[model samples]
Target: MMAIRDATAMRAAVADSWHRSAAAGVLAEDSCAPVTVTGDQLRDLRDAHPLARVFPLLDDVLGQAARDCDAIMAVSDEVGQLLWLCGAPSAMRRAERIGFVEGSNWDERLAGTNAPGLALRLGRPTSIVAAEHFRHSVKQWSCAATPIHDPIDSRLLGVLDVTGGDAIVVPQTMGMVRAAARLAESELARELLVPSRPDPGTGRGRIAVECLGRHELLLSVDDGWGQRGQVRLSPRHSEIFLLLASAPRGLSGDELAVLLYEEDGGSSTLRAELKRLRDLLGEDLLVSRPYRITADVTGDWLAVEAQLAAGDVAGAVRAYRGPMLPRSTAPGVTRLREGLADQLRSAVLHSAQPDLLSTWTRSVWGADDYDMWVRLRDLLPTGSPLLALAEGQIGRLDREIGL
Candidate 1:
C-alpha cells in the first residue's frame, strides 16, 4: 500500500482535506467526481433550488468576465453538486476533461481537495492554486470560490466559483468571487424579505413583471401547473400594464391615455395599444370597460415596496435594481419610479446597515448618490475596508459638484 504522502508541506486546510479524502477512499491519483444527478433529475433539482432564482444575476455579474479571462464560472449546491457552468467554449471544453461538468458531485469526500469543496467544507471563501488539489488530474487547474448563504435564515445555499489556469488564483480573483457571492445573497434576501400574496381562490398561479432597468419588461408566469415561462413586454404595453396593475379599480381608456401619453386626446392610439396587449395576455386577463388584469400580479417595484414596508431596509436596497421603466416618459410611470426610489433611499439613509449601504453605493442608480455616500461614510467603522471606498466615492462626487 502506498503510504499517504507527508502532508506537512501542504496548507493546513488542504492537508485536512487530503486526510479526509484518503479516509473516504478517494483515489487522488486518477479519481473523478461522481455524477450525482443527471437528465430530468438535475433539471428538477435546479428548478426548485433558491440559487436558480439568482443564477442569471451571477451570470450577469461574473460570466462575461470569466469568459474574457479564459475561465469558467460554476455554481454548486450546498452539497457541492455543480448545477450551472458558463464561460468561453474552450474553457468549458477544458473543464469537462476533469469531470467538472454539471450534475457532478465535488464534495470534499468525493472530489478531493478543490476550491468549491473546500469553501463549502469551511463555510467561507477558498482559493486553491495548482497542485494544492489532492486529485492529480485537477492539479493543473486553479480556482477561487465562495459560499453563498440565504441572508434570511442564514442557510448555506450554494457556492459560486471561477476556475481556470494560474490567472484565476490571484487575490483579485478571490475578491471578485467573494463580492459576487455577497451580491447573490443580497438578491436572495431581497426575494425572501418580500412575501407575495397567493391567489389561491383564482388559481391563477403567480405572475411577476420585472420592469426595473430594462426597456422591455420580462413577464414571468407560473401556471396552475408546475410549468413556468417568460415573455417580453413592449415599452408601451409595460407602462399600460404597470398602470393597470397599480390601479386597483382599473383604468378607463381616457384615464389610461392621460397617464400613458404626453398629449391630450390620445385615447384612439391608447385603444389600439390595449388591443395589442389584450391579444398577448389573452382577452380574459385583459378585460374591457375598465381595462385591468384579472389575474393576481406582482412586480419588482411592488416587491421593493413590500420589503420597505416590512422594515427590511437591506432587502429593499437589494431589490431596487433601478428606476421602473426608465425609458418610459409616461407621467404615471415617471412619478411611480421616482416615488419608489425616494422611499428606498430614505430608508437606506435612515437605517444605515453598512453591507446594504455598500450595496447601494455600488449600484448604477446610487453611484453618484452623494447623500448616500456621505451616510455610508459616517456609518462604516473606522477600520472597515469599505470605509475607503465610501470616502473615495464621496470625494469623487464632491469634485463633480465642484466642492
Candidate 2:
C-alpha cells in the first residue's frame, strides 16, 4: 500500500521524472509483476473479439515484462472486450472492457477518446501523454500505439497498444509501446504472408505476396529473417520468393530453376524451394504449376489488371507493394518501382473515396510523382475535405525526405 502511494505521490510531485525514467529505459529493465484480471475474465473479453483466435499469442506477450513497465499491454477490438488480461498479474480480476474496443463508430468514437484508441481511429500511429486522451477514463494514462496495416491490402488491421498506468502519462514508456506495436505488426505481416488461407476480401489473389512486408518479414519467408527475426532465406532463396510473389500466372519449374540459378536446370532445387515456401506459407501459394522460375511479369500483370477492372480497390493497393523484385538488390528493380508508383497514382486518382486516395498518395512518394500528386490534390472537390485537407499534404512531403 505504502509503495503504491509513495510511487504515486512521487510521480505526481515530479511528473517529469517519468519522462526521464522512460528515456533511461526503466521499463525494459524491470520484471513485470501481475495485475488483477482472471483467466476467465480474460476469456470473456476474448469471446467478444474476432481476434480471439490469436489470443494465445497475446497472452504470451503480456506474460513478459513490458507489461509491468508502468502499464499494461493489451489487444482490443473497435468495440468491447477482446483480450483484456494482465501484462502482469495481481490485484484482482474484473470483467472489464476497454473503451477503445467498445463499439462501431470507428475513427474516434472510441479512438478519439484515448491513445491506443485514437491511433486506431486515425488509422495512423500516435502517442498520447496525460491529458491528451479525449476521454476522462483514459486521460490519466499515457499511451503509444501504431496502426497495424494488413500484410496484403495494407488496410488498417488494428492498433497495437502499450498503456502506462499514471506515470505512463509521462514519456518513459514510449519506446516500449512502440516496440510492442512493431512486434504486433511483424507478427501480422508473418501471418498474412507465411502460409495461411487467403481471404478474398483482401486485394491480393488467393496467392498474393505483399511487397511492403517484403524487406521486413518476407525476408524470412524467403530465407534470413532480416531485422524482423530469423527468417531463413539465403540470397538465392530470396530471389525465388520475389519471383513467385511477382509472377502473374505462376511460373514453371524451368523458370524457377532459372530464377534460382539452378546450374543444370534440374527441377529438383526448384521443387525443393516450392516445398519450403509451401511449408512457410500454406499450400495455396501455387496458382497452378509444377512451379516455374521465369515469372512472366507481363502475363501475370493481366490478373492484377483484372483485380483493378473488377473494382477491387484493395487488390489495386496490394499490387503496389513493391520495388519490383524486392529481394534482388538488383539495379534493374528501379524501373519496376517507377512503373508501379505511376500505376498506383493513376488508380488513386480515380478512386471515389478520399481516405483510400489519401493512403495511395502517401504510399508512393518522390519527385517523379510530385506534380502529379499536386494535380490530384487539386482535383479533390472543394467539398471533399480530407484529414490533411489534401491541399497542404504534398508541400509537407516536399519539405521532408524524398520518400
Candidate 3:
C-alpha cells in the first residue's frame, strides 16, 4: 500500500508501469477481469502464432524448473496475450481464479501493472511483488518476467513469466526466467541458420527460399560449408523467382513481361529486371535462352502446397505464413496468391480439424473472412471466450456487407 501510494519510491520500471496503467484508467481496485479466448479459438491462436514455434523449446526449459514449485510458467505474445500456462494443478487452479488462463489479454493497460505486462511494455526483465500490482485483486500474487526477441531482427516476440506467491519476487526467479528466454531466442536463431535438405539430383547445392511472408534466398554448397547469410529478394525478384521455380521450362522475355507487368512492353524492362536479378544471384545461376533459374529451389510455399496435397491440412496451415508478397500487384503474383489462398481456405473450411478452423479465422489472412468466422462461431461451445470475438467480427462484417 505504501509502495502504491508513493510509486516514485518504487523501482523505476514498476513505478513507470503503474503510472502508465493509471493514466490508461486502470482502476487499482478493479477485479482484474480477464478478456480471454478459449476452446478452439485458443488452440487456433496458439497454432498459427510464430510464438508457437518456440513452445516446445520453452517447455523443455521452464517446465522442468516449474515442477514441485508453487510457481507457474506463462508465456505471452508481444501484445501481452497469454498463450500457454503450465504448472501444478493447485497453482493453476489458483491462477484461474484470477483469470490468468491461456488466451487471456494481460497487457498492462488491461490487467494493470504486473510483471509479464510490464516486461513486455518495458522490453526488459521485470518483477512485481505482492502489493505492488495496480489491481487490488492481483496484489496477492508476485511475478517475474522477461521479454523474448526474434534473434535475427531483435524484435520482441513475446514475454516469459514465472508467477506465484512471494517466492517469485526473488532475484533467482528473475534470473531463471531471463535465462529461459535466452535459450528460446537461441533456439529460434539456430532454426534460421539451418538449411533444409537439398532436393535429389538438383546438383546445385542446397537451395531454400521463403516466399510466405518475406522473401529470402539461401544456398549452401554440398561440400558442407553452408552460406553464413541469406540474400533478401526485392518484390520483383521474388515474383520472378516464384514463377521460374514453378515452371521449370521457364518463359520467354515477352511472356515474362506480360505476367510480371500486366502488359506487353518490349523485352527492355524484362532484360533490366533480369540483369538486376542476375547481379544479386550469380550470373551462372540464372540462364537466358528462356529466363529460368538454373538450380531447383525448395520454397516454403511449395512445402505448404505439398503438405496440402498429402491431406495434411493441419500441416499446411502450420506452414502457411501469409499471402505471398501480399503487397505485390503483379498479374502472375496475384494469380498465384489467390489460387493458393483459395486452395488453403477451401481445405481448412472443408476438412480442417476444429482447431485448425479457429486458427485460420484468427490469422491475418483469414481474420476478415466472414464465412470462416461464422463457421468457427457455430462450432465453438456456447459461452466460450472466443465466441465473443467471433460474434463481434460477425457483427462488424454484417454492417460492412449490409447484412
Q: What is candidate 2's lDDT per residue for 1-403, written digit by digit as tens?
A: 0112233444242233333222222221122211212365345434644355444665566425444553556565432122443554321121123332222122331123344545654566567666544334444456666655544345554566666655555454556555555666667667655563333342222322334424432332222122122243444555666565556566667665655552455566657766776665444334445453321133233344567778876556544444444445432233444565566667666675544454445342432355545665666666332322234455545667565
Estimate, for each residue in 11-109, the C-alpha lDDT of model 1 and write its tens digit: 899889887666555667754566656897689668878899999999999998899999999999877889999998998998887889998878776
Encode model 3's per-residue lDDT on 175-236: one tens digit a residue: 88889899988888888778756434434644577777553433332322333246767777
In angstroms, the error of model 2 at 201 is 30
Regions more than 4 Å wrong, model 2? 1-127, 131-141, 144-158, 162-213, 216-232, 240-306, 318-322, 326-332, 335-337, 364-376, 379-389, 397-403
lDDT at 170, model 3? 66
Root-mean-square deviation of each candidate, in angstroms?
A: 15.7, 13.4, 6.7
Overall lDDT per candidate, in order of appearance: 0.80, 0.46, 0.76
Question: Which TM-score value belongs to model 3?
Answer: 0.67
Winner by lDDT: 1
